[model samples]
Target: MPELPEVEVVRAGLAPAVTGAVIVGVEVFEPRSLRRHDSASGHFADLLQSRGVLAAVRRGKFLWLPLDSGRALVVHLGMSGQVLLRSPGSDTDRHLRIRLQIEHPEHGELWVNFVDQRIFGSMAVDSMQPTRDGLTAGYSGLAGGATGADGLAGSGLGWSGLIPSQVAHIARDPLDPGFSAPLFLAALARKKTGIKRALLDQTLISGIGNIYADEALFEARVHYEQPADSLSPAKGRALLGAVRSILNRALAEGGTSFDAQYVNVNGQSGYFSHRLNTYGRQGLPCPRCGTLLVRQQFMNRSSHLCPRCQRLR
Candidate 1:
């Protein structure tokens, strides 16, 4: 599954092409892709046609495009989902789930194809909800789009910007400009769960998954199973810093891509996998202490760490 970096890459790639574009056509090649679509419980294609997109926003793993109709188009790239931008006469991508023919003011007509091999990914048209913080929902680019009669850039109600109702509950990612580190630290001090589990909790801090958890722990020199509440305030801060560092580096490297299923809008894979330190490098020597790195099963998944450096204590 794509995590923050991967999803952010897609979101950034889509911002320029998707924002300000009008959906002229909607074709659903696979009905399963619309499983999450509200459609007011009606026709998915009918509700979305001719809706002008304001901007693309992403909160955690959820990506949404606020529409002129006061709704949002949400996308969840499950396991092997890919959103590819292509020309009208281009070759159709395999496993294409949904395709949107959008006309951009500057870029002209283009196809936004949602391709998913596992069918776990989905597209939805959902209602909007104001964020509790009254801040812009998440990271967005090119806030350009069609204005309403009021001459507002988005839905007239878009003051502070609303997010998809489905995404309203998710916490902001570490990279979000609005993320409150002190609040997250306070919450971290309250968790009774392991650090990795706490990191994976979307309600606590969004956009982290198993892979980034291990990498952040490795950078912080903390064990994955280290108790969250047990961490000292300084250690908690360090861990959060490590989280930010790893995520930023991953984003810079275009995100970690270990297989063909994960790719950017142009179908190019990320190279961060080459820089992995602990995750998936079981039995490899630790870079710091030369101790053997190990992988252990936790929560039915695996965690890689250097036992010498990340001792549980």
Candidate 2:
């Protein structure tokens, strides 16, 4: 699954290429990738035709493209979706699940394709309401009452009004400019679940998945099985810092690609995989200690950690 950083990298790559460019055509070779409505195939094609891309932004792991038609193109990469940029007239590959031909007077023709083999990716054209209500509303407090024009009603698991009190039960976004360390600690203090499980809980801290959780826990020298409530305030702060550091580094590296499916728009694997200290390194010597890294199944996901480095309390 593409985490926040990976999704952010994809957003960064597509923003400049598609922004201000009018969508001239749309092709959906696989309809299962559409998540919002049954008629999305036609609606998406019609909405993008001649409509300019105002902006391409990311909220958590979701990608939002504001269009000139007073609507937004909302996309979720799910477990294995990727967006690739191909020059116009370049031979289209069979993996191109959804392609949009964009034309910009200055930049010439560009082809943006969303490719996925698992059919888990989603694409939709919503009148900004679903985008606002679903994804943007999650950041309303951070956005300071600035709601996008599509007028989406805020609705999702653990999402409510713009007040922190309503959103207090929700997890803080590590990428938010106003992410509160104290608030994160408070949330951590309240959970009795394992540290990894707590980190995975969107109600505690949004956007973390199996890969980054293990990486962050390894960085903090905290065991994944450690009870969240038992962590000290300082340790909580360290964990938060580690999460930010790991995510920023991953974004800088263009997002990790464990398989061929995750290549960035330039068709390159994320560089952070080379810097990984613990993730996917089972049976390998630990960088900190010579102890062999262990891999275990937790919450139906594989976790990699150095048993000596990440000692359980």
Candidate 3:
């Protein structure tokens, strides 16, 4: 699955071409790609046609485009979903799931193709609502909060800006400009889970998965099994900083692409995988302390760490 940096790379790549472009037509090559909409594929295509894509936005791992009709076209790139911007007559991939023909007076004709080897990625039309701050509905202001009747909390009345309803409970990522370190530290002190487990909790802090969790822990020199509540405020802040720094660096490198499935909008693979420290480098030397890296199974997944540096005490 693509993490925050990977998704952000895609969002940035698609924004320039898709924003301000009107969807002249939508072709659903695979009906399962629109399964989340729960409507017929034809109706799904009709809802998006002729609507302008205001901007390509992402919150954590969820991506959406706020359309002219005040609804968002939510895109979930399940496992192998790739959104590619191709030339009008470009050769289509065998796994192309959905394709949108867009037109821009400035940029001319283009096609946005959603290709997925696995059917995990889905597109849906969802209602947009305001953030809890009541200031604006930009991605920066959106933060995770209580789950409401519709599964996300809000003012329950007229909204100001707009965000997809499904993303309401997703906490702001560390990269978000509105992210608060003090607030996150307070939340971290309240969790009874392990530090790595707490980091993976989307409700606590969004955009972190197992790969980045290990990297951040390696940087913070904290063990995965350390109790979350036991972390001091300083340590919590350091962990958050490590996360931000790591994410920023990965974003610069176009995110870590270990296989062909994860790629940029142009179908180019990321080189950050070569820069990874401990995610997939078990039995390798730890860059910091020269200790042998080890892997352990936790939550039915693998966790890599330097036992000498990240000892659980």
Candidate 4:
């Protein structure tokens, strides 16, 4: 699944092209992609037609297009999902599941295609509500979000509304400007789990997946199995800094796209994979120290780390 950086890259790439565009039509090649809607494809298409896309917003791995109707179209880019923007008459992708036709006065007609080879991603229409102050309102991943013309009510950005039900449980990611470091530290101090496990907990901190978690832990010289509560204030700060730095760097590089499925809106692969140090560098020499990196099973996924540098306490 795409993490913060990857999803944000797509959002940034999409916002420029899709914002202000009106939905002209929709094509659902596979109804399974709209499984989250609980309704038929006709209704899904009907709800979006003529609606203006105000902003391409994202929180962690979740992406949404805020429409003029107060409701937002929530998008989940599952493990192998790709959202590509192409010219009106371009050849369709073999895996295309959903195609959204939009009319942009300046850019002309365009097609936003959602393609998924594994059928894990889905699109759904969701209701919006206001978030209270700086804290996320309804659920966790639903916390901290992008502000725009359709912002939560009273936030100056617009109404402070948020998409409740589905995303209410996702916590704010560290990259969010509104992310509360004090709150994260307090929560970390209370967790009895491993630091990496805590990092992967969507409800605790959104967006740090296995790959970035390994990279951040390696950079901070913290073991994946280290107890979360055992981290000192300085170490916690270092880890958080590493995460923020890694995410920003990844975003700058267009995110780490090792698989062909992960790409930006232009269908271009990310170059950050070439810059990765620890995620899939097992058996290679550590960049910082002259020690062989190793891989271990973690949360059913493989974790790459330099055992010499990331020693467990």
TM-score of each: 0.93, 0.83, 0.90, 0.91
What does candidate 2's lDDT look like per residue over 3-78, in tens digits?
A: 8878777877787787778998999888788765446335768777888876675556666676766566777788
- Tell me how far candidate 1 lies from the true structure as C-alpha RMSD in angstroms: 2.7
**Model 1: colliding residue pairs:** none
List candidate 3 stretches off by more than 4 Å: 38-42, 135-160
Model 1 CA lDDT for position 178: 82
Q: Candidate 1 has what TM-score?
A: 0.93
- Quick one: RMSD of model 3? 5.2
In angstroms, how far off is 85's CA in candidate 1? 0.3
Among residues 3 or more apart in sequence or in different chains, the pairs in candidate 2 whose N, CA or C atoms overlap within 3 Å are 128-150, 129-151, 129-152, 133-153, 133-154
List lDDT for all candidates, in order.
Answer: 0.87, 0.75, 0.82, 0.81
**What does candidate 4's lDDT look like per residue over 38-149, in tens digits?**
4643388888989998767677788888788877788888788889999988998989999999999899899999988988899887767655444433212223443443
Over the stretch 1-313, how does candidate 3's per-residue lDDT look in tens digits?
4788888888888888887799998888999887678463337887898998877777788888878787888888876889999999899887999999999879999999999898888888888877755433334222432122222234442222457787777787787765678988998898888999889988788888888999999999999999999998888889999999998899889999999888999989888898899999998899988898999999999999999999897
Off by over 4 Å in 2: 37-42, 129-172
TM-score, predicted candidate 2 vs. hidden true structure: 0.83
Model 1 residue 276 CA deviation (Å) reads 0.6
Per-model RMSD to reference: 2.7, 5.5, 5.2, 3.5
Q: Which ten-residue region of model 4 has the weakest summed lDDT?
A: 136-145
